[model samples]
Target: MAGVGLALRDGGDGGAPLFAAFAGAGAGLALAFSPTLTRAPATVRPEDAADASGLLATVTQLGRLIGVAAFGTLFLNRLESLGASGAYTSAEALLAGMDALALTAVAGAVSGLVRRRR
Candidate 1:
């Protein structure tokens, strides 16, 4: 759904496609959070469950911080290099950042699947 919305973003439909894409992505992330939080601690012994949960939370937060920082840097760099053409440059920067993020996500997913298979 998110992918469909993203692919339709260039249709010039008054931002509806982008909004739907973001909404779907947000919903997907929200849905995954609970199961991930629950499952992380379940892998530990009873006494270590609390510690595992805490570690999972800490790592999740740190990853978010790093991802945001990296994406911000990429966007800013692209925006600057594009010579400040206003909305067009900004859009290009955003697209570049999103593309990088999507690639990173696909690579991570692939690596995770490979590791699980091994």
Candidate 2:
């Protein structure tokens, strides 16, 4: 749903669609985060639970950092290059960034599903 909303964005519509997309993504993450954190420790022995939890937290934070860095780089590069051309606006660059992030999210989800199946 979030992916669909992001992909559909054309940089001309009102804020409602963007808001909905963000809301949907937030809600989905909120729903998935708790169970994932809970389950991570459960897969380990009692004494190892803390280590598992710590590892999970570390990985999660690292993933977020990498994602933010990638997104920022992509967005800023697009903004600078396109803005220089005078043919595209910041909004268009923003939309491009959002679309790239959405595609990345979709790919991650699919890969996770495949890993789980295997």
After TM-score superposition, the amount by which residue 3's alpha carbon in candidate 1 deviates from its true location, in angstroms, is 5.5
Q: How accurate is candidate 2 locally (lDDT)?
A: 0.77
lDDT of 1 by residue, 68-110 (tens): 9998999899979875655454556666777887777668668
Instruction: Score residue 19 of candidate 2 by CA lDDT.
Output: 68
How far is each candidate from the true structure, as Cα RMSD in Å? 3.4, 2.7
| Prediction-by-prediction clash tally | 0, 0
Against the true structure, candidate 2 reaches a TM-score of 0.82
Each model's lDDT: 0.71, 0.77
Query: Candidate 1: deviation at residue 32, Å?
Result: 4.0
Q: Candidate 2: where is the Cα deviation over 4 Å?
A: 1-13
lDDT of 1: 0.71
Per-residue lDDT tens digits for candidate 2, residues 1-118, read: 4353354545565466666776788887887787777777787998887788788989999999998899889889998999899987777777777788778878977997999998
What is candidate 1's CA lDDT for residue 38?
74
